[model samples]
Target: MTMKKKKTIFTAVVLAVLLAACVAVDLTLPSYHIAVTVIKKATVYALVAVSMNLLNGFTGLFSLGQAGFMLLGAYAYGVLTIPVAKRASVYQYFDGGAIQFSLPEIFAGFLGDTVGSTVGMLLALLVGGLLAALMAYLIGLPVLRLKSDYLAIATLGFAEILRAFFQWNALGPITNGSNLLKSYPTFAHATPYVILAGLMIAVILLLITSTYGRAFRAIRDDEVAAEAMGINLARHKRMAFIISSFFAGIGGGMMAMYMGTIAAAPFKSTLTYEILLIVVIGGIGSITGSVLASFLYIFSSEWLLRGLDSGKFLGINSPIFKNGFRMVVLSVIIMCIVLFFRKGIMGDKELPDLLDRRSRKRKKEAAGK
Candidate 1:
């Protein structure tokens, strides 16, 4: 087979195996298992991290407003998906909320409970993405004009402002006024989360290979040169910002589904920092890197090392292994990884690229013989 054919087959096989494994685990384990939670959380992070990487790595836009967009999305999904009957309890502080009709209910009436609710959930996510994109457009008009650290600062400030605005009592009827948004429908299985995140990431991969992705890369490399070559610098930057925010918004919806509850307090600047850290560790410009790094990071922090937090880890039980110990160990490991691979684990290369390199090396060795 040709190298391209081989790569395609390999990727397909890997995906199939992963799907089967996930399904098996989901069927065999309890819903509250750490593995299930890790998978769900990792997929959510993978989508958001890739979205951030699109602007920061692929397009060289250093905006730090991911959490704000996510907050917008989470609220959008929560506000739109709460069942009509449950609104009274979920929104007791706000007189059953400003919007009473749930998207799921509207669709379920005609499409049946199963498929209709699924469709409704997807629609709500799309709405959240659109809302975030709109906000990005308005915010980008002024903030995008800033450069480097100024741009980062402006975006971070925007996130903080957005978080506070959501908590404001004046908007309680819509946002629940600092209360948790819960009782919304959520996926009981990890498969759906994996499928959704995979589809979204695949779309991003396709975008990266298209002409627009090239334009993004050019701008990242040198704005003056790209602009001189007929690329619309301002327009592309705005597009990148808007598109990234759109995906971030959708990712936020996924996050809400995973958490089963969401509050504005969790969508803080620290959340953005964590996503950014994932992008950096995954290799900013590589989609596969982001995805792999996300899973690895989540597994380490959420599952593999969780025992340290309870004062016991691996066969060793020490006083030092008490609350927050896992984070300390995780931090040291992250530092080691960073020091070892200055450019990140994948360093801008995809899985196929790595395979090709290995193949070429083997050929060279045979040729020398």
Candidate 2:
């Protein structure tokens, strides 16, 4: 068969498979809601993982500011979309509260009045992305110049500083310092997590397939080599870092909105480490690995570890283990994955390459026969 015909057939087959999978996934099961919630949580970690992969996996950068970006995005979206009256209720010190967008303020047409909450949520997500992107651009400037461990420390410190800044009395008008915020909007249906998961998956696919993504990989493989070949290292590195931060921020924003409260303490070093563990366990540079790892980590924490320690069986109740048990098991799992599989599950390989190799091998065997 001609190459064009073969290509067309392959494209059709893939499209059919994807459509079938979507349909299958859409059909509800007994744990439909639970699965959706898990998927959403997985998506947040996956987005941050992909962003980190673009830097550390593909670009050879080792930064750890995902938590910071997430916080920034979360707060930005939280503050922006809030209704002015509700702001004071949600965060007491503000007094001024939040500004509400009129139908015309949010939309452009006659149907704006009837645009619905879904449309408004989408807009809020977009705003989150933009704000995160802007924050990333600003942060990327000074930090991107550093290399390796220094960069990682710098980024980690940046996150902590941001957390501290939020807690400062000067910023109390918005964040309300140590006080908890309430009465904010929530993504009640499938959970903010489901929306976040879907978005991160779409974004990971977009970045890895795009020309910009290729550039990111090239820079990761060898910065000097990439620069010598006219790759514009600084510009591309900055771009990749900013994009990662932007999505991370969006994830954070979604998390904040869903939780209906934001506190500086919970989002500090511990949050950063948990996400880092998710990324490392998932494989540093592999989007698929990150995604799989997130699910594994979250689910295992919720179910497997609990089962193991609690000794819960077919009909017997066992004493539950302390909360720290899950973290200990998770850490061991991460270490094992790192030690046994250094390159991660996907490593530097794209899924398509494996398929291509399989097809070529089959073709060769057939020709010999």
Candidate 3:
């Protein structure tokens, strides 16, 4: 085999080993169920972080409303996936009685037991993503015209508008308004979510590594200069926005499936801010950093913050921290990270670079020997 091929094989083996080790370590956490749940949630957030980074990080767009897009995706996926039989019992908010659709026999065979439900769920998610991209394209026409704070407000307004629109009874047939959609699929195994997460990560990684992705970076660095250099700024900007929104929508659908319940209010500006927090803490344009940060942020909130807030520290009982303390602490941590470690943990660098460096060092050491 060629030297390059050998090195590639070795790298893949090493990465697989590392991944297994990490999973093993995660399994050893104090609460296995909680650990699994946190991981599942993190996977969804990781997708969001990557999507947001694609625009905010590489493309230099300060667009918000990520949460809104996610909500849209979640609802889209939820409405389509609930089993026909259980629709009446589960979806008390709406009456989607007597639905019918047929899947190909091979796909049905491959999906096995959950074929019908899973396929519906997948279709919903796909549709949600497409819808989000459509919304982004439409929204971008007007919102992208603004820059900086104006753009932020416009995007924020768009999210609010979406929330309000979803909450309105006129669209209740589709959204169920404020009523929670029940009888939805849960992350019982979390395998589907994990798979979706993997696909999203792969797509983002592939796109960001492509020449088009570099163009996105150029537009982000200097829109006017990129345009002057013969790059289609508007086209690229719109593409980034649409693509980011697409994934954000998918992430939202994943969240809905994982949570099994969602409310429109919770998916507003507050969520947008939280995602931004994760993105910033993870590093603006770094996908690896975003993945790590998503895990850190979600796990910290679920495990660490919840424990602290519940006052369950070594059998102690006191509410000294009080409510909202978690947010306060999170805010402080974010401030510190931003102030002390401005380039984010990874900045523009990816995690694979570290592994590459280690591999080269080992090769150099062997040569010296």
lDDT of 3 by residue, 326-355 (tens): 667778999998889888878877765655
TM-score of each: 0.98, 0.81, 0.86
- Over the stretch 38-65, how does candidate 2's per-residue lDDT look in tens digits? 5545656666666666667766778888
Q: Is candidate 1 or candidate 3 better by TM-score?
A: 1
RMSD of each: 1.1, 4.0, 4.0
Question: Which window of ten consecutive residues has the lowest lDDT sum in model 1?
Answer: 333-342
Which regions of candidate 2 fall more than 4 Å away from where they truly are? 1-33, 96-116, 191-200, 308-320, 353-369
Q: Following a full C-alpha superposition, what root-mean-square deviation does model 2 have from the true structure? A: 4.0
- Kindly list the per-residue Cα lDDT of model 1 for residues 1-369, writing each as its tens digit: 999999888888888898899899899999899889999999999999999999999999999999999999999999999999999999998889889799998999999999999999999999999999999999999999999999999999999999999999999999999899999999988999999999998899899999999999999999999999999999999999999999999999999999999899999999999899898899979988899999999999998898899878888888888889898887787787677876787989887777788899999999999
- Where is the poorest 10-residue window by lDDT in model 3? 97-106
What's model 3's overall lDDT?
A: 0.79
Summing lDDT over every window of 10 consecutive residues in candidate 2, give the lowest-scoring window: 102-111
Q: TM-score: which candidate is best?
A: 1
Rank ordering of all candidates by lDDT, starting from the highest: 1, 3, 2
Supply candidate 1's per-residue lDDT for 116.
95
How many backbone clashes can be found in candidate 1?
A: 0
